[model samples]
Target: MADSVIEESDYIPGKDELDWGYEEGAEWGLLFPEANGDNQSPINLNSREARYDPGLLDVGLTPNYVVCRDCEVVNDGHTVRIMLKSKSVVTGGPLPSDHEYELHEVRFHWGKENQRGSEHTVNFKAFPMELHLIHWNSTLFNSVEDAMGKKNGILIIALFVQVGKEHLGLKAVTEVLQDLQYKVTHIQHMIQQYTVIFIFVLQIEEFRRLRSHVKGAELLEGNDGMLGDNFRPTQPLSDRVVRAAFQ
Candidate 1:
C-alpha cells in the first residue's frame, strides 16, 4: 500500500463519486437532498470523464490474469499463470480485523508512449509505470502496506513501461493475447492470488473502441434502470396539457 497510502483524510469522494452510481447518488442526495435531480448533459452526464476513476484501476482491471512466455522477436509465448505469494498487510475497515488479506498478485498495462502512459493516475501525474497493489480491504498488520512493503514493499504492483524492449514479467499475461469475450468474473481461477493473471494492455484506440462497444451495447439493451421506463414514456404535450406547460 506504499502507493495506495494516504493520510486517511484523502478518502473524500469527489463530485463524480458523489454523482456516480444510483447507490452513490442516493447517499449523496441525503446531504444535498433538495438539489436538482434533472440532468442536462448529453447522456445525462455532467462531464466527459465522469466514469474514469483512479480507484477503478485497483478493482476493475482483470483479476484472473494469464500471461505468455514464448515469443520469436522477444521471447513471445502463450499465457502462463504465476502464483501469488500470500502474506498479510494492514486490515482495518468499518469492522474489526488487524491484518486484512494478503497481497493477491501483480500485473501491468502500458501504452505506445509517454503522453498516453497508463490508464490510471494519482493527482493527474503520469509516470513511466503505474503499479497497482491489490490487497484485501478486509485484511492487516499495521495496515495494508505492511504486507505490501514486505518484499519490494510492492506486491500486486503495476509496472508501466514503453512499448519497445519487451518485458519478462508481462510474458505471463500477454501470451493469452486473444481477446475473447469475458462474461463472468474471473477471480475463482485466481491461481495463487485473486482471480486474474495480468492485463495484456491496450492501445488508446482500443480503449476507446472498448468503451464505445460497451456503451452502445448497453444502450441497445436499454437497461430498465437507465432508461427509467420501458412500458411508459412521456407523451407529447398535446396529451398532457391543454397547451404546453408555459401556455
Candidate 2:
C-alpha cells in the first residue's frame, strides 16, 4: 500500500487528476478539503436578500486596465482561460482600500444548453453563460502563488452572459476558442483592448443595453468536444453574507 501513496512533488495545482466532472463536484470535497469550507464560491445571488452596502456604492468598483499585447488563450482541460501577461489592477468597491487586487486571468463557464450554463444564479435563474475575471491581492503578496489560501487573497468579478446580438468585444477571444478546441492547447493572442472590454461590461447602463443578444453558443457550435458544459454547481452560502452595491 505504501507504493500507492501520491507524492506532493507530483501534484499540480488546478490540474484535476481525479477526472472530476460537474455532476461529480459534490464529491470534490473528499479529495479537496477546501471544497467543503463554508466560504466556498459559486453561491446563488439572491437579489432581494443581498444587503445593500453603502460602502460599495460610495467607493465604487474601479478598474485600471491597459492595452495588453502579451496574452495567451489556453484551454486547460476544465475551461478556456485567458492568461494576462500585463499588469492590470482593480480597486475600490467591496475590497479593502489598503489592498489592490491585480488581474491575473479570465475564464469562461458555459453549458451544453442555453438555459443553464452559469454557476451563480440570480433569483434561482441561470444565465446562458458566465465570465470570471480573477484577480489576486498584489499589495500583500508578490504573486498569486504566494496569495493562495490567504484571507482576501482573491477577488472574482462574475458577469452573466445573456442571449443577444454579437458582442464585438468578445469576437477576438471567441474566435480563438476554435483553435483551442483540444485539451491543454493554447495560442498567443491579444485580447483586444482590455480596458474597453472591462469597462463595457462593468457599466450597468452599457451592459443592460448590450444584453438583448449575443452570438451565444452559435459561434462555438462545433467545438463542443472540449468546451462541454464546464460550470460548477452552486455551493451552500452557509454563514457568509452577500452584499450588493445597488438597492
Candidate 3:
C-alpha cells in the first residue's frame, strides 16, 4: 500500500498477510455480516455461464450528469473519492420506473506494478484497476446514509480501467494526485483536488450517453492498473444468477 495515498487507519502492508477485513480475511464477517452473506458483490463474471435474456434488453441507463465547477474530492482513508454535487441521475438499468437513483460518489482501486487490482473478475481474469461509481435511490430514500444496507437502496456501477493513451476524461482528476499525496483522512476536512471538473464531466457524460446504446457487459469491460492493489478479493456467488442482454 502507498503510504502517500492511503490513510493510516485504512492502510495495511502486505497482500500475503492483509490486516484489513475488507480484503482477504474472515474478520470482515464480524463487522459486516453481509460479507459472508450470499449476495456479496465483486463476483466473478463468467460469460459462458451467464444467462441471456431478451427481456433484459429493455433494462437501460439514462444519466444526466451536469458540469460542475465546485465539486468536492476527498481521501477517505479507504479510497480517493469524488463527490458529485450535481443532481446527476441514472434512470432505468435494472431499476423500477419509480426508483430514481442519484450519483453519490466515485472511487477507485488499483494494484502494484505487476498485480491485478480489480474487485470483480471476468472468468477469474483480473483487471489492473476498477472505478466504482456509487449511487443512492433518492426517490425512496431521503439521504444516502439513510439508504445504507437497505435492499434496493444503492446501486454501484463498476468499470474496469485499462492503461493506454492518457484518458482525456480522467486527466483533470488524475493530474491532481500530486497535490493529494500522502493526504490523511479528516471527515470534516475535505481538500479540493481540482477546482475545475472538465475531465470529470466528460467521463460521466460520455458513459451516460453510451449506456443507452451499449450492452452492460461492453460498458463494464477494460483492464488497467494504478496505485498499489487496493481491491478486495472476489467473494462467493451463492444463488446469484448472472444475466445479460443478447440480440
Candidate 4:
C-alpha cells in the first residue's frame, strides 16, 4: 500500500465523514450499512470468555515494522493519524499464511476523560486511550482502497493505552501535535521506533499494562488542542469468537 494522507475528498458520507462524533455513532448504521455488520470491531474483549486458540500460540503474530522518515501526521478533524511511507508488513497468527498484511496507517482514539477512551474494553473496564494500527492484505490487493470491505481484506491491531512514565517512542508524535492541531495540516517527520515498540510491547510485554490508571486520561491533546473524544461505541460481537494466543 502506498503512503497517502487522508484528504477531505476521501471522506465517505457515512463512513469517514466528520459529521458524526462518538455520541452520534449509534446512528451510523442507518446511514452506512457496513457499520451494522455482524463482524464489526471494537467489541468488549472478555478475557475469561475468549477461548484460547492453541493454533495462535503455534503460529504467533509476527511484525516487521521499519522506521519511516517520510511519514506525515495529520489531524483529520476527528483524530490524529499517521500515514506510513515505508513498507511494514506482518504475517502469521490469525492471518492466513498465503498473504501478508501491510501496514498503512496508525490512528489514535481518545476521550475527554481517562476512564473511557479506548474503543475496546476488557471485562467492562475502559482505558485512557486506544491505538489502531491498520493493515491491508498486500499480497491480494494493489491498495488499501481496493482491499477494504472485502472478506479478510483488512486487519487492525488494537492496543490499549494507560498512564505511565513518559513513553520515549511516542514523544515525537506528541511533540508535533501543536503543529497539526488544525485539520488537514500535517508535519513530515520521522516516526522513529514508534511502530516497532508498540507492536513489540503488545505481543511480548505484560498484558496487565492495559489496565486503567488514575492519571491516564489527559494523555494527548486532541485535534483542536482540547481533549477530543473521537471513538465509536463498542459494537456487538454477535457470533464472533475472539481467539487468544495465550493460555
Candidate 5:
C-alpha cells in the first residue's frame, strides 16, 4: 500500500497554485464533505470572549521529550516537515483522563509575505508563521495512521510566531533552508537537545509568570521568502465554544 500511495511531489505539474485551494472548503463538499464539517480547525480565537474554564486551567500535560539525534527533515513541496523519532509523549491538555498522545511529526506553515501565515489566528489577526506539533492517541491506537480515523484520535498543538528576537532553537533548523532550495530533498539533522517537561497547567499568577519564563522556541521571527502562504482559511466556530486556561 505504501508503494502505491502517491505522495505530494515537489515538481508536480502545477502544484504551486494549489496552496490556498482549500481542500476543506465547501466547494469540495461533494468530494470531502468533512471540509465543511462543523469541527474544522484553525478557528479564530477571540481571546476576550473565550470562556475561562477552571477545568481548563488545570489541564494536565506531561511532555516527555528527549534530545533527538539524526531526525529526518523533508521539503515535500507543501511544507518543511521534521519527522520525529523521539518518543515524545504529550498527555492531558484538552483530553480526557488517562489518554496519552505520541508526537508523530512537526511541520511549518508560512506566507509569501510576513503579515499572516498561521492556520489559527488570535482575535482574527494573523501571525507570521505557525508550528503544528501533530500527535496521535497512543493508548487506543496502534499507529498514527490508524488513529487518524477516529474521534479524539489526533491532537494538534498550534503555536503562533511573531517577528521579534531570533529563536535559538529554530535557528539550527533554519540554517538548512539554503540546502533545501530545491524540492524533494531529504536530510538528517543532529538537533540540539532542549528537554523540558511541559506542564500546561495555567493555574496561578505565579505560574503565569513561570509560563512566560518557560520558553524555548514557541515564538520566532520571520525568515525572508522561506515558503509562501501555506494556510487554510479560518473555519467557522459553529457550535463550539472557546476555552482558556489563563487570563
Candidate 6:
C-alpha cells in the first residue's frame, strides 16, 4: 500500500502497532493459476524474526507481465514476466536449489474482492490479489499441498495494496489484460514458469515511515476474519479441490 516493504524493528509493535497490510505485497505483484509459490515471510524457519527481508526484494523483478487468461486478473491478449533476477541469470541458478522449488506465473490484487484476488494469507485475511512468489518444498514434501502440512513447506509474503490512487507501476499488468478479449479470449505471455526466483528487498526504514499514508486499513476487520472461519490453518486444499472438481 505504501510502496514499501516491512523493515525489521528490533521491537515488535503493540496490537495497535500491528495492522493488516504486510509490505511484501509491493515486492511481488499477484498470484495467478499457472505458477508455484515461495511464501517465506509469515513462516520464516531460518530467521528468528519470521518476516521477509525488505532489503532482499525487488517488485519489478517478480512477475512483471500477465497474459489475458481470464483466471482472476489476467485477460486474453497480453503477457507479463519479471526481468529482475540478474544473479540467477549470471549463475543460472535453479533457485532455492536446496528445495527444488520453482517460479511459475504472476498476476494482480486489489482491496476489494473480485474487485481483486490474491495469493498469500495473513491472520486468515486475503487481499484483492497479492502476488505470490510461490515455491515447492522438494525434499520432504511431494507437492505444494503436501508441503503445507509442514511448517516449512511453502513461503508466502503478504503485501496489501492501498485504495486511494491507481498503481501506475501496476498499469503494465492491467493494460495487457485490457487488450485481450474477455470471456474466452486467447492471450499470450512469457512469464517464466521455472524453479527459483531472485528477490531484491525494499528498505524497512522507508516502510515504517510511510505506513501512515496507506488507505483502506480495514483488512483484518473485513477479509481476514472471514477466512479464518472457513478453513483450518495450513490444511491441505487437495481434499477441497478433489471434492469440488469431481463431485
Best by TM-score: 4
Give the worst 10-residue stretch by lDDT in candidate 2: 1-10
Predicted structure with the largest lDDT when compared to the true one: 4
Would you list the rank order by TM-score, best first? 4, 2, 5, 3, 1, 6
Any runs in candidate 5 off by more than 4 Å, and if so which? 1-31, 193-226
Candidate 3 to truth, TM: 0.72
lDDT of 4 at 3: 12
* Residue-wise C-alpha lDDT for candidate 5, range 1-247, written one tens digit per residue: 0111111112111123333333333354454444555566667889887877767546656777666675887666566777888778877655756988887877777654557777878898987677777777889898887776576676676677665554556655666655555446668896665421221221111111111111132433442323356677777776677777778
lDDT of 4 by residue, 60-116 (tens): 778999987889987765677789989999998667777899989888776666677
Off by over 4 Å in 1: 1-101, 105-114, 119-129, 137-158, 180-247
- The parts of candidate 2 lying over 4 Å away from their true place are 1-18, 194-226
User: Native-vs-model 3 lDDT?
Assistant: 0.55
Report the C-alpha displacement of residue 180, candidate 3, in angstroms: 0.8
- Model 3 error, position 216 (Å): 44
lDDT of each: 0.28, 0.63, 0.55, 0.65, 0.58, 0.29
2 versus 4: better lDDT goes to: 4
* Residue pairs with clashing backbones, model 5: none
lDDT of 2: 0.63
- The model with the greater TM-score, 3 or 4, is 4
Give Cα distance to truth, residue 2, candidate 1, Å: 7.1
State TM-scores per candidate: 0.32, 0.79, 0.72, 0.80, 0.75, 0.31
Sorted on lDDT, highest at the top, how do the candidates line up?
4, 2, 5, 3, 6, 1
| lDDT (Cα) of model 4 | 0.65
Q: Lowest lDDT 10-mer window, candidate 1?
A: 227-236
Q: Write the per-residue lDDT of candidate 3 for residues 1-247, one digit (tens) a residue.
A: 0101111112121113233423443356665444566566667888887778767657666776656455565553345667766677788756767678887777766555323767778889986667776777898899887766666676776787754444655766555554443334213223232222222333332222211111222322432211245567676666667776752
